[model samples]
Target: MVAREQFQVELSKLRGDIISLAHETEKLLEKSLEALYNQDIDMANDIISYDTKLDQKELKINEDAILLIARQQPVATDLRRLIIALRISSDLERMGDNAKNIAKSTIHLGEEHGLTIHPALTDMKNIALKMVDLSIKAFEYEDITLARKLSELDDLVDSMYGEIIREMLEETATNPQKIQHIMQMAFSARYIERFADHTTNIGESILYLVKGETLNLNE
Candidate 1:
């Protein structure tokens, strides 16, 4: 009984660490999008630099989870929890990378263009951020319904992404000289779309944690 109690404590700590990583990654993504909107080169640079911290957090989580598995030899549901924790951390880290990519897009865009961002792109950003928040909540509560909703949100993101790409393509045809700027904008939209996908991946992980059933939320 004492050993089981200690294991539960460690499991709780691991869950907390995963939540912390999720929030930090979500914040980084928000800042990255803001930097893109304002064309704040300095802010974008800071986000790029900050990504290393997220990487370290993910590494620590991975190590700690591995140690728990090795020492505790958890079976069945306990083992599933640890495995899902690792998967969630990995998805969160990838989300951070997508944010970093968005920051890089901002830097590449520079300030000289004074390009106006598309309204649809802003919509994508907002939905992506919301999905990240919802994903975390769903994981915390192990709400399968909430986790399933992420797929619907992903659909919205996908639609907006397609709209952005089509519009950008139109702009590129008319203003061939601005191809570079248009390309960067498209890349940023793609990054935001990928960020949403990762959140759905987290949602799928949550479903697996609770139901012990694998799902493809990305579809």
Candidate 2:
């Protein structure tokens, strides 16, 4: 059963690729949050370095999917999984870009003005980070229940984003000098919100992978 052995080998490689990308995503989020918290330019700059690795991994994931399809002609569920791996890796790469964007914005804000960090946004960051972590676990375990739950949890981050935006607008309206700094803060919050959305997308992808039914986190 040489064919069977070959299939197993490829499957193992695919799983390895998925796990590596997941770990990379976690590191990206951690660095982004640490940069923001410390207002460290060097840490912000490091995102660009790590982004190269992410790009490479994305390319490998796509190439591997194509090879798997061409060689195996995987049917039904197997085909769906290969497709999901390709699709979800792209989403994960975009999430990493958003994390980079947040770090860049933090650097600019720190350089432009001595802006005081808002403690409340910490809640939103924590929520987004947790979402990413749980989404990975959901994928690794093929947990449909966790995928469904993640869909509902996104609203918590969304609500906090809205409230933070309102507070910033009110403050900026009263003090024109705060406009630029507040805008940077708003962008950072938006990045975190978008990050949460990507994580939810991963959750949805995992659900689809397991159940073959589309699950939208937006609902």
Which runs in model 1 stand beyond 4 Å of their true positions? 1-3
Name the weakest run of 10 consecutive residues (lDDT summed) in model 2. Answer: 111-120
lDDT of 1: 0.91
lDDT on C-alpha atoms for all candidate structures: 0.91, 0.82
By lDDT, the best candidate is 1
The TM-scores, one per candidate, come to 0.97, 0.93
Q: Give Cα distance to truth, residue 67, candidate 2, Å.
A: 0.8
The true-versus-predicted C-alpha distance at residue 159 of model 2, in Å, is 0.8
Total clashes for model 1: 0
Reference-based lDDT, residue 41, model 2: 84
Best by TM-score: 1
User: In model 2, which regions exceed 4 Å deviation?
Assistant: 1-3
